[model samples]
Every structure is written in C-alpha cells, then in structure tokens.
Target: MISKISSQRTRCKSWLLGGLFCAVACVAQSQAAGVTWSSQYQDRLFDSGGGVLDTQFSFEVGIFLPGFTPTASNVDLWESNWRTLDRAYDPTPEDPNDGDPEGWNVPEQFFVGYYQIEAGGYSSSPDADPLYAFPGGAQAYLWVYDSKSLDAPREWALLTDGITADNLADAWVVPDADAGSLEWYLEDLDVVIYGGGNDLQGPGGYTLDPVVFSLQTHSVAVPVPEPGSALLVGLTLGLAALLRRRGLSAARG
Candidate 1:
C-alpha cells in the first residue's frame, strides 16, 4: 500500500513538473511570435521616406526575421542616405585649404539602420497611412551591398524573390563584414508592398523597389522586456527544484 501511494505521488509530481515546463515553453513561444520586431517604434505624422507611416527599431539582435542574416552587424553599420560621388558633387580646389577630395572616389555613402515599414508591425494596422495605401499582394525586396569591395559597389544584391506577410515584414538585414568584423549594412526586408507593377511587383511576384525607404521623426518605439526573460528563467528553475524535492520526499515516505 505504501509503495503504491508513493508511486502515485511520484506520478503526480511528474505531471505537475511537466505542466510547469510546458507552460513556460508555450509562454515563451507566444511572446516571441507576437513580440514586435522593433524593441521600440513610433508612428510618423507625415510620410517622407518610402511613404512610411510607422518605423520599427530594436537594439536586440533577433528583432529581425530568421534567415535574413545568419550574422548581423550593429547599428553603427547603417548606411542610409547618400548620393553618388560625381562631377556635380565633386569638391572644387577653389579653397586651397580644402583637403584632398581623392578619398571621395568610393562608390556609396554608408549608414546603419534597422528594418522599417510604412504601416505598423501587426496583422491589423493601428497606425494611419497618410500618403499611400497598403495594397494587397505587396512584394518584398532584399538589398545587400559589399562593404569591402574596392569601389564599395553601388549595386545591391537581391536575397529573395518574394516573401509572405506574417506581420513582421521589414524584419531582416544583410551585414557588411570588414577585416572579419561587420562594418556597413544592407537591410533584407519584406515590408515594402509594390502592387502597381506586375511580376513579383504584383500581388506576389519578386522584384526590387527602385525607390529608397526613408525614416521619419514619428516612428514608433516598442520597448522590450529587459528583465522579464531573466525572471522567467529563475522561476522555471525554482519550480523544478521544488518539484524534485517533493518527489523525493514522497518516495522516501
């Protein structure tokens, strides 16, 4: 009789312990999926660049989608806005004090910025679009630049044909590595919905946007839980130890 009672208690303990772990796992997954890609974001009143109404941002690495970049560079690598260095832009030696413009021969200017979209990062749009409407069957475009090239190639390489909208569009980036360290950036995103054109530019075709997506002053800033993850880890461990102790007591009795 004692043995049977002990076995039953052990089973009960096992069930409870399993449930605790399961609860934690489920909570973590949901948090991950529902969590906004940007650690913080803000809504723009007037769409200036790429007609973006909302811009997303995050300091953490996973803010972007998977496969976007197996490895990503920090924010310092963002190369956002710059015109080509040409005759019109060339500096004249009119001022003898002016330094040498020879160094300006590089292909493009570099700025490191995270991914962003016009609409808010959600299945349902909470932010209003003042400039353009978000159309159906919008296509995704990936732009990757070579930071180490001698000319710093003006061209951006394509990463994919088309990507589905899972509410986390514009959540990827391409890293520019230099001397085994990441230098500049190219964003691998899927938020720009190009509907006017056919092909991938159509509802679900693959094509690159000829235009650039610019950031505004009103972008959303969604802060992530800095302490919650660690707390959850502690709770999980505590519960596990408690359950184990109870099981041992039951077995001995």
Candidate 2:
C-alpha cells in the first residue's frame, strides 16, 4: 500500500512541474512574432545634401515575398533623402596641400530599386512611373574608404559594386583576430536603365537625375523560441531523477 501511494505522489509531482514549464514556454513564443519593426522617422527628418526636410521619411524591411515586385505604393520600406559627404572626395593627392573640393557632398542614403531608373535616360519619377524599369537590369555601386582612416584612400577612386540593399539586409561585420572592427560602408549604387552611355545623357541638355536608395541602419532578426524545447529539457532531467529514486525504493523493499 505504501509503495503504491509513493509512486502516485511521484507521478503527480512530475505532472505539476511539467505543466508549469509548459506555461512559461507559451509566454516566450507569444513575445517574439508579436513584436514588430519600427523606424525612428518621427525623430529625424530626411536631410538631402542641399537641405533637410520638415517631415520624416518612411521606410521598412521584412521577409521578402517570393517573386516580390516592388512598387511605389507596395514598397516594403522607404528611405529618407540622401546624405551628402561634406568633405572633398579626394582619395589621393600628389601634393599635401591639394585638398578635396569644399562643400562637395555625395548621396549616402536613399537607394532605388533594381529597375527604378534608366541608365542614360533622365528622371526617377516616383509618382508618374511607379516602378524603376531597367531594361537590361542594373548594378549597384558605392565609394568606400581605400584605407581604414577617414582622411583619404591611397588610390584615387575606389568603387564598390559589392554592397546592395538585399545584401545589406543580411549583412553583418564580425571582429577578427587582428583588426578590431572592419570598416563597413555603402558607396553610391547604380541602376542600369538603358545600356548605352548616350542613353544616359538625354536628348537635348537634360542631365539624368540619379536614382539613389538610402543606406538606412536596420535591426537584426531575432530567432523565435520553440515552446516545447525548454519544457522537454526540464522534464527529461526530472524523469531521470524519478527513475533513479524508484529503483532505490524497489531495492529497499
């Protein structure tokens, strides 16, 4: 009789502990997917090289849909105006005195989609033309620091065709053994409109407006926890202890 009662009590204790663990697991899963991404647009306005805007620019990034076609209205995210590099863009100079041009700013923020603009043609109209239609597709480019220091690059011009919006989304820089933090930068990206150089230069004298996309900083995706995982671990440990105790009890009997 005593053995049967003790066995029942052990089973009951295990059930109660397992139930409590499951409850805690349920709470963790709810928090992960429910949390949404948000941009701090309200705090800062889009600042173009020329000037800054009154209102904030809207933008977002999420799981890219399969065969996702980006439109102005259906834009998953938006970037603010471009930020111009204030200092002169002199990567290298023959003489020490020869400094970069003053008040020269390059567009850093505001990246355009793959087909947002034509290579040689003019105008990236967000309203009139919703999609950026590049006939032959386009290549994204940016100017990065030749050397680690911000002062200047040893080479004259260093173009970056590597970094893209899609790449940046999943991009991360890890600290290496030698160097502390490798420099991560996005130079200007190009969207190929028409193939030829003449097409880039419009009919009369109209200079094609650069279709630029912004390099906005974004948050990383967090892993969703499995509700049952923690509980399984706890239960496995408890079961092992219970089995050992049962064996001991039998031996005593």
Candidate 3:
C-alpha cells in the first residue's frame, strides 16, 4: 500500500513540474523570435504621352498580401488632370456612351478601386468613365514583375484598367498636384513602355521590367523562450501540483 501511494505521489509531482516548465518556456520563447524586411517604395508620380517622362516611382509598403486578394471591397476614386493629346480618341461601340469630349484634357482621369468595399472614389478628369479599367474586367490583375529576377515579357499582371495613354496621364499627379501631403500605395510596378498600349508587352521579352518597386515589409519580434527554459518551468509546476495533492492526502489520513 505504501509503495502504491508513493508511486502515485511521484507521478503527480512529475506532472506538476512539467506544467510549470511549459508555462515558463512558452513565455521565454515568445520573447526571442525576431524578423526583418526590405525598404518600402515611395509614391511614384511622373508624366508621359509627350515622352518617357518618369520621376518618382515607388511602391507602398507593409500591405498584407493574403488579405488584399482582389475585390470591389476597398473601392477608391482617383482624379487626374490629364488631356487626351491623341486627337483620334474614339471609344469602341461597346464602350459606354457616357459623353463625347471636345478634346481630352484637364481633369479627365478618374479611377475606382476597393470602391464598393470601402465606399469611396476619386477622379482627375470630370469627364471620365467609372468603369474604364475596373479590376473586375480584363484589367483586373496588377503585376509587379521583378525586373532583376523574372523574365520581363511574361511576368506582369493587369493592375488597373482605364490605363490608356491618355488615361495614364490622367492618373499622373505631379509633385505639385499633391493637394496637401498625399500618401499613395504602390499600385503597379512595371517598366513604363513609352508606347506599350493596354497590351503591356516587354521590350526584349524578358521576365521583369526595368521599373521595379516594392512595398516595405513590416515585421514584429516574436518572443520565443529557449527550449531549456520552457522545460524548467513545466517541471516546476508539475512538481508543485504533486506536492499539493500529497498534502491533501496526509490531511485526510
């Protein structure tokens, strides 16, 4: 009988110790893990149509990818002061009969994204189509081809739609155009092919483009207790429990 009781006591003690050790270890480990990331691309703003006019081109950083899959969820309206330098600016029959322009110019660019989701929209041009290049259409996907790593010609996605030569300029916001301090997320990171129409083909059929921008990666340090510390904590709790049980038994006797 004594042997049996002793064995039970020993087992209880071990369990208590183990529990304590686990708790401690968990705390330690949680404090030890660390993470790092690359720099963030700044907002890019430049001119085109006249020539390969590019200046500030960069990407927004720290956006959670898995979360930003694609949806009308976060719609935002963008306005641009652009003019259709192309005199032959004609829309396809399928194109919505919104209105005819005397000539495409000032306050002509308007774009929407995450609009339905967030209930917001903007326009650079007063006379622009709401559905010009919506993500839900052929101009749905946005590609950020890593010019340095991937092949240029095949590694891009249709970021935004209404992205015509004229429309592209509509979205173009010069540094001076930034009303108040403006903050923009990098939407498209691609080589601005001077004349590459909506097709967006590469120069030499390479994987990536000369233009490359990236979002800043944000990280937080995770605390991970050392294995040894965890073990010790668990052991202490287990032992304490076992001892408490023994005391109760002794009182009953």
Measured by TM-score, the strongest candidate is: 2
lDDT of 3 by residue, 1-253 (tens): 9999999999999999999999988754443211111112222211221111111111111111222433212111010211110111223323324432321111222112111100112222323243332121112222222121221221211133234353312222222211223222233323222212223432222322324222111111223567999999999999999999999999999
Tens-digit lDDT track for model 2 on 197-244? 111211111122222322221111223346799889899999999999
The regions of model 3 sitting more than 4 angstroms off are 32-145, 149-253
| TM-score of each model, in listed order | 0.21, 0.24, 0.19
1 against 3, candidate with superior lDDT: 1
Stronger candidate by TM-score (2 vs 3): 2
**What are the runs in model 1 whose C-alpha is more than 4 Å off?**
34-153, 156-253
Worst 10 residues of 1 by lDDT: 81-90
Clashes of each: 22, 24, 67
Worst 10 residues of 3 by lDDT: 77-86
In order, candidate lDDTs are: 0.29, 0.28, 0.28
Instruction: Report the C-alpha lDDT of model 1 over 1-253, residue by residue, as the tens digit.
Output: 9999999999999999999999988754343112122111221111222232211111112112322331112212222211111111113424423332421111222122222222222122122223323232232232222221223212122223233344234323221111111211122233322121111221212133423232121111222345989899999999999999999999999
Ranking the candidates on TM-score from highest down gives 2, 1, 3
